[model samples]
Target: MPDAIDVSATPSDLTLVQDEQQRTKSRELSRAPFEAPPAIPGYDLLHRLGEGSFGAVWLAREKRTGKQVAIKFYTRGQGVDWSLLSREVEKLAVLYTSRNIVGLLDVGWDHEPPYFVMEYLENGSLASRLKEGPLSASHAVRITRSVAEALVHAHGAGILHCDLKPANVLIDGNMDARLGDFGQSRLVTEMSPALGTLYFMAPEQARLDGIPDARWDVYALGALLFHMLTGAPPFRTPEAEAKLAQARTIEERLVVYQQVLEASPAPTAHRTQSGVDWRLADIVDRCLERDPQKRVANAQIVLDMLEARDNARAKRPLMVVGALGPVLFLVALYWIASTVGPRIVRTAEHELLQQALAGDAVSARILASSIETEVRIRQDELVDTADWTYVRQMIRDSHQRTKDELSQLNKGNFPDAELQLAFDKVTNHIKVLEQRLAQADRTLDESWFICDAQGRQIYRFPDAGKSLSESFHWRDYFHGRGEELDESVPHDKVSPRTKTGVSLAYLSTSSSKYKVSFATPVWDEDQKTVLGVMARGVHITDLLDQWEPQIGKEGRPDDRFLSLLETRGNRPHLLDHLRIEEALKRVGTQERGEVILRVSPAVEKALETTDRLEDYRDPIAQLDPKFDGPWLAAFYPVGNTGWTAVVQERRNLTLEPLGQMQGVLTRGALSAFLVFSVLLGVLWYFLHRASL
Candidate 1:
């Protein structure tokens, strides 16, 4: 989910056909006769589209009608009962006219390997489309619905598409689906169906011995939907497959298969982390139910659920608008202009100010909640990537080699080229890591550097511009002022919770920006003794910048009204603030270290009070011409961090509303504004929920 599988970013084998060169390469598995076409009596074989284990399917022209069509040659004629082929022909005849399915145009029983001519679809298979990465939610839903409809038709016709995967779902010129490749299909009356593609295969189907039912396709539907949303199939690992393949007996195979079934790799945790629509994820979960009896009754049930979810999402905004009407109506009729009109206006103005104050609190809460979510998400990314086997190995290999080189240098054996080569590998490895981090769902990712076990710097993104002997043994992260903790002695942590021990810091030697720097030890596979420390940080200023367009919407060009995070450290510190305003510029101009405040009434009041909005003057705000003392402030805590999103505005500027003339037009505007606050409250509720 972090790395969205968008249509333009195909991954590995899921890559779609982009050019003739790729098409040629894809046919590396194509076993279709290159020199001579299958001897179909009337149809002239054109070019091969693709081939499978059983036979090759080709594009051909009908001599009688001069119409382009696909011809499939069933080459394995040695032991396949001719009568089973005859039964398949009969089934195909019935399915040829079904909607959302590949149409069968004609059949030939007299060729060297019997051939059948079907209509040609040029676009390609779903596998090829997925090569472009994961489809969008709408496209995924539509495609699944269409395929479910096709499954319904096949199930009704007493035929089972035993193998249902992206490769079998073909697309035509219009991007409409056509369920093709019925090579593994069997009549529904069979006691047991053939094994389908393992990734999409239902658990019971792994036994290849069950009374055929519609639930088989139901499971496949879920797997297909999962693939579309998540890009990769759940638990589709070569290692798992190879283990099953290597099992020597039915008992051994069943044990391994049952393990896989119990794993039930659908609806992965990563999928949940992706923030996909819950309704869609639920549909996939239902389809992937491990117990066949507990799964959705049929493909039709899944389709019905999908459509219902879509309808509900479509009506959400309208539902929200309607729900706000009653509250607004009550506020609009609070009082009329008459004997008590002046008092009424005053009270209304009071309520309006209260609402504006509430709005400030809401805005701050939104920003805080969003930041908290970002922190948790980024931490998750850091942990997941840091724990990856290949990543750990790469880091260890580079660091271990560097340590060995340093040891040799200490013994006075100068292996200059070898040492340079070792450093070069470390540098190159860091470069690769940085590139991957760039592609990952990182926030800012200012720099990623690593230190060897001896506290010497090994790698930095900009190459550190320093010699390999440079050590960070005195830094706070490595050694700090704690007599009990032992400054020179070291310890390490490797897991998720441990990797997220981020401390605040300012960027650059000039301290022009702020960031959250996390230093966690990289360990061997067993997570024992530390091999090295990998440090990652992102400039928190970039977070403020990202919210600029939204935050600046209601404020002036100079950004008089702005939001920032304040942390209650030894004293209050502006953890991350935009430097666009005067007060911030005056306080945050330090060339080194962070700006930590000892005393500020505005900040203290906001942190202590539960009130949505309040007013206070900073003691330091009046010292300079550029600074403003009085502030219209709003505050809220961020996910138990003792950090708050604080929005501060120049006091006089925000009080303009109270200074407006008491006139008919002015009254109307105030009334309208109050009424709109009800609607705004509703909008905020939804937005906050979405952010969470």
Candidate 2:
């Protein structure tokens, strides 16, 4: 046990005790007065200052020192336990050494239960001052800083003033602050049923099985600051039930704070009663962050911010003089450009024109068509991988079925059965295959499309084809040689094959893999002269589905896994995973399997690279190395038409280890708390003169 110091400032007096008894008797006539004489102590009873749910505090003058002090007496039936009293005494003893903290003078049994003596304060608590109005921002900050400094010391000693509030802080004659009420304080690691006053209680402290931490004090400090600035705590209400409900969740309290901040008139616009700075209001807001993690970690940070704000204000004049001076000195430079710079430009242009000449039309047209094709291919490839795969598979299945039926007819195997039966079977199979083909065609027709060099449609997904140009002329194929034509190929007047139904076209001569007819120039074989333009298209949807099996196999439980390919541009095409998987199964049995095509960011980048267009860039690529878990993704490119794949997984399954680590940390914290409690008890006994 810790030692106790007997610093009772009030002198022994019987008159004060009788006066208190009379007041108590007047308040409650039914209650009996003490029949036994108040004895067994060397202290005197004094006039009662206030009574609360816990106990009453009295102002008394110690007989030995003749110093005025406040003595708090706990009643036997006041719902306080001996163990709780002992813990409170322990905390007060440790905190007494700090000047800003209310010092515990002595603990003695003057009546049925023990009472503790503390240094008396002349000025009332901050709560009493707030009864008039909210404090000016600077005044509140100054008071808060003093209390915070005391907390910094207490926390350093592993003690938390769990019940911190305006009422618990005393103002001296000098207006300096002294933090009081260690009756509910505890070591940082200790978890006690007695937490804090309802309004000041942290959400975690309200939990039945919550593990106490330093954050509890942090929250109370914020609440105190809020009260100082706003004239009330964030959740103060006339009804006790309402206050309790608000204390249940930190988020609800934060919402209230945000509403108050947003709705309340700006403090800067209002004049302060005390000549205090308004900037302190911002600091209070910061301290009241909804997330504990985002709050100021300690008192030091608050002090640092205050100091920095002061320093910046002090340096403002210097900044204006040194930096602003140069800008003002250079005001003449702007007018010089408008008045004298154009004549020199005309002279230079005239000299350069003599050296320049126009290039040949044939070579220029070919170059322009090649560049246009490349740009179109790149843009088409920017479709999402999942969408691309679905569209590709649909096209591939349609083509395969068509080819298979043609082969069957060529093989002459349909005449084996009776004439009626054989005809019916062939008709039924053809109808079913035709339906499949029609569905595939519908899907591919809706996919997006872009033509390559020689007027070939290198990327013709259904969505792309809907708006593609039908016909292409020689002039349309080779227009913009000097400038880059990286824009999307729009469906306008170009002629398309109605049977094949291509909606849009572009030319790409940059890569061999996707070179299309749009890139090829028309030639007359007999006359050996350039003729016109030819168009070609690649079924983009068919190519996308080709990669579905690989993605599905990589993520087992194909049904559970969903893949998507999105185009890397505005109004991108979508290829759903389920659609592609169905297409792959229809392709028949192959070991490596049919390639399911899907548009993805990777495909978009590959297309762009092949199209002689700038490569697609991803911002999240920087964060990928850190995120190692699986997720359902819905990613898209930041600027370019590039696809982003968003994958989502079960939260519990993904963060299992993190949960286990938290459990370990929780247990360790609890164990550390218990050990600290025992040490606290020992320290308290030695300091309070209760040592064994």
Candidate 3:
């Protein structure tokens, strides 16, 4: 049977609430006693299926055919609008042949209580099924599409179901939609007004003078779909219902309805529902657009869109594969040819460079150890000379002389002949030691000097011809390994002497070259008291001269070089002899001749705390902006000498093979891509011609 208007349906407005209460009152008055069954020729009345204010629907069976049907009896003069009934019957008659519409049988207009018969759909209405919960997206969309197809057929017949809702949509025995309840139906050409259910009604249709429009049905369809998917009509909230009840007049209620829908946030629950996607969501959103101009034009277009959506879903997998095929193939090519191949070459090249750098670091360590040994030997020579019996006796005999005689000798006065003769013997012994030290190593050109206990230099090699003119008190070698060795301390404060001390590197006053002194304290025979200090100096150039032949050797590239840095004072200073010599040769002795060269800040930062080799940029490389360095370098500290040895090599030579391999990989990828494209093009050309 066609669905009865659900008396249980929630009322929308203050007027509808009063109308529903009145209908409830009338239903009680017209139950079976007040309402009489009209006798028909071949049908027997079964029972009252449902009742409304104007009429009641009863279940009946044709006696001869034994077929069930629903009869809606319009009670005469019970506020029945005969024109509305006429319009509804006319619309149904036009859509009689449509399978999606409920079949209308017979109508008796002149009967005491006029009635009409409709096919009995035993499964009831969509609204009854929806009371359980929201339907799944698949089920909901399927039902929505079926209803839309019915609308398309109706619209073609110039009919609009203005009151479309779940209750109006009947589910037949086969569970297929059969649109019915066209009480508010209008022909497309009619200007008469129709108001659908609240929240489902379009804003334009809520106006008192609203005219019939197809978009009104579009909005109802969206609301119907939304209800199926989310279990409630969009904007039909408890709060909205309460506000709607507050409106006293039908005009006020209609205005409030429009306001509630327009002001509320658009419905989005369907978007997050289990099986809903953007495509379906978009269709519902378009149909529900508040502005009719923006809404989907008609139900036919809605049906067409739904069909397209279904077609798209069916073809999605094929489309995905077709779109992603080339991208996946290119990714494979990059993995095999570009990434793995070049990475292998780079990794192998990196390992080889590390091995070579490690070997270089070892070589630097060896050179540093050799320098330490040589310095130690020189210190031992000085200690041995200081321990000489004749040298100690001469110092003792000189100290024994009167203070007046010592002062007079220093002032060049021969106050005592014996003291003068003792000074001469000490001077002669110093000259002999100086000659022996010079012959021992030709690099030792700086004079060896002897300082008395008072820190006065009484003798110098080759004799500067001045007696006791210089004081050696403010020297790090003179003091011990403590803070006083800085050479900035007062000369009067004598520090405890070291066994053997190497002074900080300083520029030679005479030769204008960097030199360092090795000193040992001379002692009395009992070794209880220090008599004086004896020291010899060697030029930095002489110390680094050992590397002269090693620099730029046959296998050593010119870009690779070694350097020495004095790791004392405020910052590390370059003491490389090769660098100093080059500068000297360029300037020809006009420069101050300081061996140390300050490095760039970047290089100094790298050298600040590192004690081992690492990748290094040549400090001087920044002098020329064009140099791309990234040199591999090793730094080894020369033992206890306050100097670091550096061995550096250009990195490009080591990575040259890797660079070539990368180039080959890049070219190969491009070539493979081009060939693949060409092959595809040729294959497509042949296939095209074959199809023709």
Candidate 4:
């Protein structure tokens, strides 16, 4: 900000100049309580200020609110009609904002005649100010720019001030202009029934039923600028003005308007003058174009030009700042970081740990919810594989045929050649049944198998060309010759088989391992006989691995790991053997004669209660030679499947909110400063423009 800008002083204080009669009329006073008809009943009439063509404006006080106001009363004798007075009020209702606009205060049409209640301006109109003398280029641009801003506000709201002129614009105590008098204004969507003051109307605006356009106001502003600069109307010559005045009715006026103003461009008032600003003159001339299309597009563009004029003059100090700002910003940023970075990091360290821990727990909980569905699917697979009666019939027929063949051979009822042929045919039938079973019992990590009531393996899917080397009865799920449950080994919860029913049993094929299997005894359709045991095994790790990426993008984070843990026994075991990459685990027990890694305390605690646990601290460097601690851990129990999902994380894995806040605040402050400086420079430019 420039030193000349009195930041301590308000904008209102700067606009008030030393003048007497002007100041007296501007003064406001409360009126004594009064009541009357044909007059504003709620207001005390202080004194009559001025009278327009149809109404009389008075400086008065509203008795109820006690606020000083300018009341324009429609005196029936002033040659005014209800439409003009009503139109003014309707326009103000839709278009108004900003201190630069003499806004509507209150209105009344309840009496014999209505009146306008509006914000009172102390400095009067620009026409009154111009009576003293011509304004300098700075004062002219500032005043015009202020009015342009008001026009922008009005146009944005779809109202065009078609009758914009010096008399309709009021200047306040701060020398800021306020636009008023919307009598001739029209909605942007409506055609004009009448033109505004002839001197200010654009060529198209003068025509009856003229469609509303933004260029109408542009022409008025140019006329205002021209009047401010040259102390005359914007017309090329006095003859052109006289010619427009000679036209009488709407039709005659249209002809003269075309002959004079629209015939050709002539000497504009600014061009005829010697000591005028060419830049401002050119803008005014463009606005006064006979063709509306050639004029400036909108009031906002004129405002931008005026603002740009001020900006161009005040570019000196801003250039200096632009040259050195980045260098200083970098240096200041470095200094602030050195002074405050550690404290910020310390405060954020604890928060980062908590966040990372939360991410771990959340990811684990998500993965845990998926386990029940997988278990159910495995159960369904088991039931589906065992439900085949054809395979069971083939096995029964093979056993029965073997028995018959042995008896026949013992009875010496067949020749050696005949016996050999019958044996080969039975073997081929068994092979065909094995191939059919293999088609139905295939998976990512499971195979199909069948055994006789004696625990001897009979059929296997992938071992179609070979014989079973081991009996499945050794597995716990197949205890008691695949029919009876061991007293020590409880029935599998998932699709467990009944002694004489068709249900299938699902259990761990290999104890303390990721291998799961479903087994059922193939029974006769009459429920009278058990054929053999049928089983399909799937490695649970394959399911876990397949779901990891789909759930929270597990294992993608450097500081985190996701593991599935089984919690069925005294201690939990990693289903996938997910241990610290290069670290050894402390084992507490052996499962199925193999030393296995156990779940961390966090996971064990989760299994005991609450299905979820957080805040496990393990040194990452110890876990992985490539990384270091402090790593946080969390786990979720997968719904009675006795498996848990555990997520791990380290300090380096999460975002740094404080550091990002620091950068945002720094850039924001720098941007705010630049904008503030430019505004102050613009205010300083008022002095330069005024001098010119």
Top candidate on lDDT is 3
Worst 10 residues of 4 by lDDT: 1-10
Better of 1 and 2 by lDDT: 1
Q: Write the per-residue lDDT of candidate 3 for residues 457-500, one digit (tens) a residue.
A: 65566434443445557665666552225445565677437477
Task: Give the alpha carbon lDDT tens digit for every residue of 1-692 in model 2.
Answer: 00011112111100011123443553463243432224335556566676543355677777776778877766533444466566666777887778888888888754565677777778878877887889877687788788888888887787777777777788887888888767667664354434465456665455444444555676677778777777767544445334334543443433443444444443332223353455555666556554443455566556656776778678778656634343332332234335443453444333222111010111122222322333354333332221222323222222223333423432344333443343344334334533664674421212223332223332232222322333222323333221223445543423322121112222222221211122232233342433322223343333334333322323443322223334422333333334333343444343211122323445344544332111222222222322233322223222221322322222233234455655675577467556555665666677689543
Error of 4 at 39 (Å): 4.1
Model 4 per-residue lDDT tens digits across residues 41-79: 788878766643344677888898888888776653224
- The residue pairs in collision within model 3 are 1-120, 1-121
Which candidate has the highest TM-score of all?
Answer: 3
Q: Which stretches in model 2 have alpha-carbon errors above 4 Å?
A: 1-42, 109-111, 237-279, 316-692
- What's model 4's lDDT at 159? 73
Q: After superposition, how far is residue 462 of candidate 4 from its true place, in Å?
A: 89
Each candidate: how many clashes? 4, 122, 2, 6
In model 1, where do residues sit more than 4 Å from their true spots?
Answer: 1-35, 38-41, 83-88, 248-255, 264-266, 269-275, 327-692
Better of 2 and 3 by lDDT: 3
How does model 2 fare in lDDT? 0.45
